[model samples]
Target: MSAIDNLPPLREVIATHQLSARKSLGQNFLLDLNLTAKIARQAGDLAACDVLEIGPGPGGLTRGLLSEGARKVVAIEKDTRCIAALQDIAAAYPGRLQIINGDALEIDPLQHLTPPVRIAANLPYNVGTELLVRWLTPPDWPPFWQSLTLMFQREVAERIVAQPGGKAYGRLAILAQWRCEARIAMSLPPEAFTPPPKVSSAVVHLTALPEPRYPADAATLSRVVAAAFNQRRKMLRASLKGMAPDIEDRLIAAGIKPTDRAEQISLEGFCALARELRRP
Candidate 1:
């Protein structure tokens, strides 16, 4: 039995099932139950929340979520090889663990879960940022999940929580901080995973705000942010010239200098600019 639960240890389960992490799938199995539990705890008060987990290889973190009293855990895994192993975990918890064999990118998690939902996962490295951006930019405000506790490469994690004027800060920082409260919950070394990744990883926790911290049309804001940062070093006048015929006038009206670079603009500043561009 595993130290934390009645289920077998992750290593034993992997060996028994002959489950090997696949580079193509961006899999790096977390074999340490202690660390998994720590990641679970970072989600905060899972007893009342339904959690959506992506890429639960060998169910290590799945077990942690179950043991910590999550109301329900709906795990999405693309690898069919891991299903039977996850089934063992479902049997152990009975009615609490729901395993879905599918690609996370293609699946809509909200369709399967109720409100007061929280997403916690050691996300697949390849699609991690794409997933986060999807969650952040959903058409609707106050997204389905109450919060997100996700793991990412340390570099990616830094970008998620990065502030303006920092080297890591850019489009990601603006998007993440504009709509949610994002922070790095904890850091893990390269050695933390079963097959140590070349770079370290970190857990980022983001709580959704009731409304965007500043108001601007979501699509407009996204386009404006994307355009500005697409040429990070260019003055806004040069980069955003295609966005509007009178882009310089819009920048002036928004109380922004057309000569300013993307990295120098704050979230609210960007919102102001987007609002100006959005005007008829």
Candidate 2:
């Protein structure tokens, strides 16, 4: 039986189904039910919340989400082999588990689900950053999910919660912190996966705020941050040269030093620049 959910052990299910990790799909199955349970618990209370799980390889984390009393789980997996495996999990939980057999990037879990949702995933490494940024830049506010509990390469996690003036801060740092409160919750080594990733991984917990730290459009902020960081070592005046002729004046208006590198400016500072960019 599964340690947390009393379902069949994942290994047995994998063996029975002849499932193996598929690298092209970025699959690294987390076979440890206990570890998955811990990741579920980190999403805070789940009693009444819905869950969005990406890449539910063998349904380990999916089971943990349901076992923790999530009202429903919307799992999206791209690999066809895992769909058969997840079908077993859906059967075990009855109506509470909903499986979408497709790439998560192609589906917006928010539109298909109700409020009080929290995204909890041991995400496939390749698409994790893209997915997180989408949530952070939701066109509308009071975002679909109440929280995000996601795993990423240890370096990526560091970048998410990194502070200005630190080596880890950059485009991701500004985008994440401008709108949500994020921090690293836990870390797992490469050995934890069925086919381990070369780099260690860590979990990041993010709770979205009612609004951003300052009034700045997410799209504009995304462009500004991405551009600034693309030439990070250069000062803002040199890096943000694409803007109007007086872009340095704009950065100065935003209260950011014209000489500051992208990594040297805080999230609020980036928002200020984004706001200034919106000006005519």
Candidate 3:
């Protein structure tokens, strides 16, 4: 069956399966087949990788990925009603789609997929940041997945690719930029999604670094970033007050201006500060 012919329109499938968007699950189904197809292409060549797609409500992106020549796709859907709809895609593709019914957070995509894995998803709004942080801060070096082609609220996307001293620059920017080469590939207005999310959305493509930009522990780095940005309105010396009395000294030692606000510092500067804090 052709990509268009094989899967029913997402709306019909959702209704037939009685799949209503559950707010608690962060569900906002993507109904436009053409839009999903465009997103699938953004992942580059899916023919070479096992695609990891999270929250594929109604399987719109799933169908697109399969049609785009995916070697295989492991779709993790938390909604049971959506699972049956995805089962149809699995049957249509035969061996190319595997629908796992659970949260993507609990399942490690790398363990389930081999090398050359790439995550392509119209992620659930709430967990998108959490999931991206997990991928960007994998405990092991030379992290899994060749790249990530994932969607986020436009504001969130700004945070991912936001530059030093930019208004959007903060913890997310630091963590994402520190470990990956990132760029915002495309943007979508609120109308792009079914039921239309209040905010616009954007797709971000992040390829992992060979190693993080600096020598530091991911956990410690995240903590330092979080503390510094939690009170971004203040200078680093004041914002990181809860961390230690020497926080100002450490910031200066790391070559970051002690008086600079969190948004003013670069990702490398954050890493350098984390290293300083990591020492006894």
- Candidate with the greatest TM-score versus the true structure: 1
**Each candidate's TM vs. the true structure?**
0.98, 0.95, 0.92
Candidate 3 lDDT score relative to the true structure = 0.85
Each model's Cα RMSD: 0.9, 1.4, 2.0
Candidate 3 local lDDT, 1-280, one digit each (tens): 2345566777788789988888888777778787888888988988888999999988898888988899999999888878788888899999889888898888866667866888999999989999988888777978778889999999999989899877888888888888788999989988877778888899999988888777888888888888888888998899887777788788888998888888888777887888888888
Residue runs of model 1 more than 4 Å from their true location after superposition:
none
Write model 2 residue lDDT over 154-223, tens digit each, in one string. Answer: 9999999999888898878887888789999999999999888999999999999888788888788888
> Which parts of model 2 are misplaced by more than 4 Å?
none
Better of 1 and 2 by TM-score: 1
Residue-level error in angstroms, candidate 1, position 121: 0.4
Candidate 3 error regions (>4 Å): 1-5, 242-244
How does model 2 score by TM-score?
A: 0.95
